[model samples]
Target chain A: MNNDYYSKSYMPGIIKWGKITMLLGITLCFLPALVISFVYGYMPPAAAILTGLLSQVSVSGAFYIVEPISYFPILGIPGTYLTFLSGNTSNMRVPCSSVAQEAADVEFGTEQGSIISTIGIAVSVMVGLVILTVGAVGGNAIVGMMPAGMKEALNYLLPALFGAVFGQFAISRPKLAAVAAVIAIGMTWLLRNGFLDFMPGKNPPSYLVILIAVFGSIFAGRLIYKKELQVPEEEKTEAK
Target chain B: METGKKYLEMANSPLMWIAAGIAVFVVLMQSVIFFRKSLKAAPEVGLTKKQVKMAIQSSAISSIGPSIVILVTMISLLVTMGAPVSWMRLSFIGSVNYEAMAAGFGAQAMGTDLQHLTPIAFSCGLWTMILGSLGWLIFTLLFADKMNKVNHLLSKGNERMVPIISAGAMLGAFANLAAGNFFTETNSLTIGSAPSLACVFGCGIMMVLTKVAKTKNIQWLKEWSFAIAMFSGMFVGYLAR
Candidate 1:
């Protein structure tokens, strides 16, 4: 049942076509501005444009580097393209991919795992699109109809969601969970106090905190795994 | 050239719709193509039809709550930007908050506000939105296939190390995100514990559900564990407020 062909044959084409479609898609996204500016002859001044980009990118530019790398292990390849294209990685795509892998009883990083994860992400994206489309078409009437209390409660949903995800992982692996919590909390505390402000830009250095926590936690997991589960070299050689 | 209200008309014009529609169509095509490929490859991967169906249902149902929040954001964006740009941006790489912020910046750059955007303001706003998100897409496009090398290098070609590293990455990323919510600025001015309480409630409910599922073997309980935890946490958080 192992279809190595997916990796051998299918994945390269998927990547190739994915890049083409994505490039076209990205280009189309910018088309509106180009067309509008040309038609109206109202192109924004270069300084103003640079100012806007500088402000936006200064805030989010680090994320562009960190997020894709941080999320790579979770989303894998096909899921990577789809998740970035669709956005909402942490809240939707990652969870969906995890659920699919769990339901399919496949290990992550495996071919089967990748397939199931891809399907899960696609379904999530399609559903999200449908819901958004409906909301857009229906306008605010639908949102206005929601109870005031429920709308207020929506603020807490993401925290709850993040907590639930963390809990799931924690329940499965308490030791690693402990390691992550310690690093996250300690680093967050330090960053909040401006302990790392001297490093570079900004007061908090939030991206650095996340990166440290991620890599630190990974190191901890590897340390624990090697001490705990690694087979003896002689036994491994014999088995091979 | 169209100016004033006439300029605004272009925001939702047929030309804009057609262009935005093409972008959305490309996204849709990718999703459909990937979905079909996965389904075709499912049997080879040991996925039963039932498992795939359950996965689909679980993910679809799970997404509704989050999607509702996004839809609400879209509604707000649509007021200023019109349907076509709002729909396309939100459907593409744009998240709710980021899109609004980008639009706002775009408007500001044009020396206007989002509410009273001229055609030029709207156009630049669109540009900012497009450029703001290109980093993620560009990174993915250039490096997605190459990232396999990262996995390999990290694992040093050890298959077992792969999952450990993945788990570490997942846990660390989620922890940092949750930590921000749980541990907000706590000083003399104000306290923001609602998010933290919601998070604790979510974790608590999940732990309890895991216990119950293990003890009772309630299949549905396991399936709905995360959703239940999340909603319950939200309710508690609301009450706490």
Candidate 2:
């Protein structure tokens, strides 16, 4: 019933289970590749494998570290485990969790928020798996039947989804929202025009843009809301 | 083309399917376990049964649009990676874009491409896909539990600022992502640009839905608002295009 119970009791159990599942996930992820390579005697030359790994790593290595750290504040501990294991962090997990907290009227980053987000993300994983399984079984036929217009519309879904998510959060804090929008638009413009082409891949690294937008907004929030944020916790709640 | 057929035979083999099944099974098992644990702990965290139920319901509804998008995308992948690998990879630890790009790089490394895959090139793709994403698992395993310190440091020991910080991060991340879509190399806020239209329409619909749901005391509207906003946005974008 108390905060101590959640912090001390509930959290440790989650951490224990999270670690175990993550370990299992890691092992299982390699199973298909291993089976294909060794059991079937289809292993590529070691040199070729190394080249492939290096090429993919050269492009994506930064994301592995940057994404997890940047998303931690929103995803929380249990969410980090579920999200990283289940993937689709931006497109699915984050929106599902954020909407869950909003619909439940729970504050983010609290114990309640963590529990609610875990439920949301777990539900998403189950739902996603069921849909994907169906797709795998007969998706090609169904997709073939789809009209070209309908198929093309799906291309716009990610942008729409992102816009909806931003709206949900921004409505509550317009000033900070403006700050984020300005930085994001400006950075995107710079990236598009070769302003950041000096970076790796002859373009601005996405992770760097993300880092700047996130921290820049946070810095703005801290500066803009300093007085409200500095009030003692009990007094703030009492005033509300 | 002959090598492509041989590669498909191996890729779609029963053994490969079984391996993919095992991988998907692990993901399912983890979700179930975490779901049960969280449900058990809900009351302790002061989440009423109704709140928990709504959370699940809303989240499930929200996932439908994106999941369908993923399914359609998977159809393209199925042609190249076979049903099992496409299913398993998309279900766990990688997005459609990441998997396709990684697999392409893998094949390119072996002097082949997705269209003309040899068995060895296919294997190379699988290896690259697995290895490239390994860092996310390794990093999270090492630091997820310890990341509370990140929040602690950001909040400067002021618990109240945690929510603000989180909100700021959400706004920033989503804004950046949405902006990326709205602005392309060849276009900037051009009329009838599908991505720009989608972003603008999505945001507008959401704001209206939120206002109406709150003013009208329509709980169902609140629950389905996200899906409605998304579909409406996409439909408008389609028409504009």
Candidate of highest lDDT: 2
> What's the DockQ for every one of the candidates?
0.59, 0.75
Candidate 2 structure quality by residue, lDDT tens digits, B1-241: 7878888888888988899999888889888988888898888878899889888988999999999899998999989988989999999999989999989989999998988888888899999999889889999999999998988998898877787788788888888888876665574644357788998888888878876775686767767888888889998888887
TM-score of each candidate structure, all chains considered together: 0.91, 0.95
lDDT of each: 0.79, 0.85
- Candidate 1 TM-score, true structure as reference: 0.91
Worst ten in a row by lDDT for model 1 chain B: B183-192
Off by over 4 Å in 2: A200-204, A232-240, B187-192, B214-217
Cα RMSD over interface residues, candidate 1: 2.0
What is the lDDT for B74 in model 1? 85
Chain A fold similarity by TM-score, each prediction: 0.90, 0.91
Q: Candidate 2 at A155: error in angstroms?
A: 1.5
